[model samples]
Target: MQITLPRIGTVAAWRQQVRKLAAAGIDPQAVIWSVGAAAPDLFATAAPAPGVATPLMLSLEAVDGIEMALLHSDPERFSRAHALVLRLSKREVRWGDRSDPLMRRLLDQQKAVGREIHKMHGFVRFREVSPPGANRRAFAAWFEPDHPVLEAAAPFFARRFGDMDWLIATPTLTARCEAGEMRIEETEARQPPPKDAAEELWRVYFASIFNPARLMVKAMKSHMPQKYWKNLPEADLIPDLIRSAETRVRAMHDPSAPAPETLPGGRMRKKLR
Candidate 1:
């Protein structure tokens, strides 16, 4: 049987379909799963009607793991999740068993999705997009995640920016929050938000807070990957900050070093003399 699921609400659709298949005692190998509008399998048989028996019941942990794994970018995630669920329901395999390759892969995928969600929460930068004299401020951001994670990550933004109207656009989907209501829709294209005046102040603040003595390029890169740097306003200063870190550190240690000169706007400038 061929099951084509929509890109949006994929997890819910898959869950409903899996319940029916499980109730009908359908083998995982007998079903073909595809997302979006894909060509149908010409030779595949129709899905059997759901039986009177109750659908498979799994532990909450297993259900959460499968849902998270399905959010991964892997095209085969649906099929793998279905197979794992069947195995789990039949008591053929145990959950979180590293010895089982399928279980291990799904667990790893779940972790990857979790990491992506974390990155999305920390990395999304909103630019003011509100028009003149607007009642509530509006902002927009563009993000490209490795996985289709906007659905899972958007709730954080809604809670964080509940007072304002905002839109976060991704490659596959867009999350919009207006009047405290949040909704997700398919994205037409990848278009970044326009630069705003506040970004300059943000860049200045970022540079001011940077501590040369605590600089760790490797650690910084690990926390803030280069892939996301392009979208950040402060990232433009990173290269120069790294280049001058050694000199700044030496200045901090030198007993005879000249005191820093204070400039307008409360900024600091070092004197050569």
Candidate 2:
């Protein structure tokens, strides 16, 4: 039977549908899962009658892994996850077994989602957007994610910035937090909020703390991919900073350079070293 799912199916939807198919003893191959509004084959079987659901149990780790993997942007993710779920339910398959190709793929995708979540948390910069009459401070940020991860990533921001009102907008969805309440709404691609004074301050702070002596472009890019640079305020400074790194480090080590001193007013002055 062919099962047609929404273009962007949620974890819950996948789980529910999988459960029904599994209960009916339907093999993954027997059911063709087409996502979005793709036309079904003319000879496709109609939706099968749902069987009495057998108690489906899986390790919490397996559940979490598959859930996050579903958020991946890969079009084949649904079929892969479904196959894995079927295997786990019917047999005593160890989800952590790397020898199994399906399990390995799931593991890799899980890691991808984890990395994306970490990057979103670290790189999302909020710019103040309060108007003149606003009693509470407001901020907003624009992010572009590789997966449908905003829902999973929202809780961290909610807890960390509990006292503030903010919105994190992305191409697929927007996560809005206000008055300690969190909400995710479907949204189209949006223009980034206007540049604010705070962004400049953050850029200056980032540059000041950057250590040219430790600069490693390859390692840096490995951790912070180039794809994310467009949304990061500090990224614009990276090229110039990298180009001049050798000169900056040389100045730091040059004995001919001035020694910095603290003045009475707490300002620092430089004198020949």
Candidate 3:
């Protein structure tokens, strides 16, 4: 009976199964394997010609009657089946394994991170923040993102501001530069932030806008998940701030807390070494 091998996505795992068949006494010399959506033309003379494939091919045959066959009962049971493929991804090597699960995962991960890194390199915002008349120059910026993406993002800042001092603090990590040297620090810990008129006022504004009459608790949680609530400056506003329309109106009317005035790019800048 002609065996029909199962396929996943576009990967034809026939080559691997064929090798296993060879070692298991299903002599490779006796069986012809060709990869495609359709079966290959069998010459029926024992030795079949190799078919064309996008990826290069490797052939193996049993020298004796003892051949190999796959334990089909468990193809994906080996977790390390993908280990070899992952190593290739890290080295930026692309392998043609239409049927290898690990190779597919490595490609997916590389694509996901490569895009995010490219965006961070282009879009990160930084602000200069050295107090006037200070001996040196300094800068700071704020950003909100879902993951620990700072270490991979530090190189962009170093390249952009090789001579200036600055810091980029996200909810999870902080990248800082001093005297033209840059380093990343993990900030999984939280400290009480300095009391700010903006945060308090934002809370008031938030509570006042919340309307019990129109509230949908399920929808609220869906739109604003628990994970993001703690890190947002606007989160504290949700609980008490949204209680009534009157409070919200008062907050809305309040003047936006004025930002501290600083000379645009203070003239006391150091010449890049």
Candidate 4:
């Protein structure tokens, strides 16, 4: 899908993008549609529903979760014209300055990009790859993101780990970044990933840090839910974490409480854990 910001001549540009896609054998229906709040009256009138391909756009503040998606089932199947269309569209939509109205619009576009990446970052699970003499590490994650951002999301891995090789496969795209280069491919499903012990430790830490007595259950569920629990070790501990809050609070505040267990030097003998 192509995402764009509102520019001075966006209407003409939008028309050109569709035409460009058509010329390259891309079914307009196949592209996921995304756009910006500043789009002209013609396209900025409605919000697209999840999984549906429609014009997605956003204001700067709302950029957190908004996008303009034009869905294409066949990504990476570009011919010469299709590739050229993408190149041309990117050049036209490039940002110039932070202060300019155009730049602000682009920032909104990029924030939508960031939010898209973040959603994948949260949902994509990494699996361990066991091999005898592998130089590059391998992991696997599965996600059915409601939006199309796999093309833009791969770079996040590069930024997070510039020296390693990795593969992030999505239903629509399979991305690999190694030896300072990144690429994407179209693929179907693959094998499930293996587990990691380190991830379990991290999940335990996450669950430990959360104080359940402060729970806003509704708000907490809004950010996370049972469906994602299996992938998150902390999720299992949430119930326990929540139950312990009241007892922990009362123990610390009880006026008649005895002194805490301490060591010889007068330091608390308690483990942070």
Candidate 1's C-alpha runs over 4 A off are 48-55, 255-273
Best by the lDDT measure: 1
The per-model lDDT (C-alpha) reads 0.86, 0.80, 0.45, 0.50
TM-score winner, 1 or 3: 1
Per-residue lDDT over 138-210 for candidate 1, one digit per residue giving the tens place of the 0 to 100 score: 9999998999999999999999899999999998899999999999998986889899987777688777888
Q: Cα deviation in Å at residue 64, candidate 4?
A: 14
Residue 122, candidate 4: C-alpha displacement in angstroms: 4.0
**What digit string (tens of lDDT, one per residue) describes model 2 on residues 146-216?**
98789889899999998999999998689899998988877665878998888777777777787879999
Over the stretch 1-273, how does candidate 3's per-residue lDDT look in tens digits? Answer: 133343321122544554344334342334533222436545445333443222222222211101111111133311222233223324433363536565555344444445545545644444446778976767665655433346656777888787778777765567778888887765553332333344554445554455645677678876566555654455754554334334334434654532222122211121222
After superposition, the stretches of candidate 4 with alpha carbons farther than 4 Å from their true spots are: 1-17, 20-68, 71-114, 225-227, 255-273
Of the candidates numbered 1 and 3, which has the greater lDDT value? 1
TM-score of each: 0.90, 0.86, 0.37, 0.52
Stretches off by above 4 angstroms in model 2 are: 1-9, 32-43, 48-55, 257-273
Candidate 3, residue 94: lDDT: 39
| Ranking of all candidate structures by their lDDT, best first | 1, 2, 4, 3
Q: Is candidate 2 or candidate 4 better by TM-score?
A: 2
The stretch of ten residues in a row with the least summed lDDT in candidate 2 is: 259-268
lDDT of predicted model 2: 0.80
TM-score order of candidates, top first: 1, 2, 4, 3
Each candidate's number of clashing pairs is: 0, 0, 20, 21
How much does candidate 1 score in TM-score? 0.90
Error of 4 at 143 (Å): 2.8
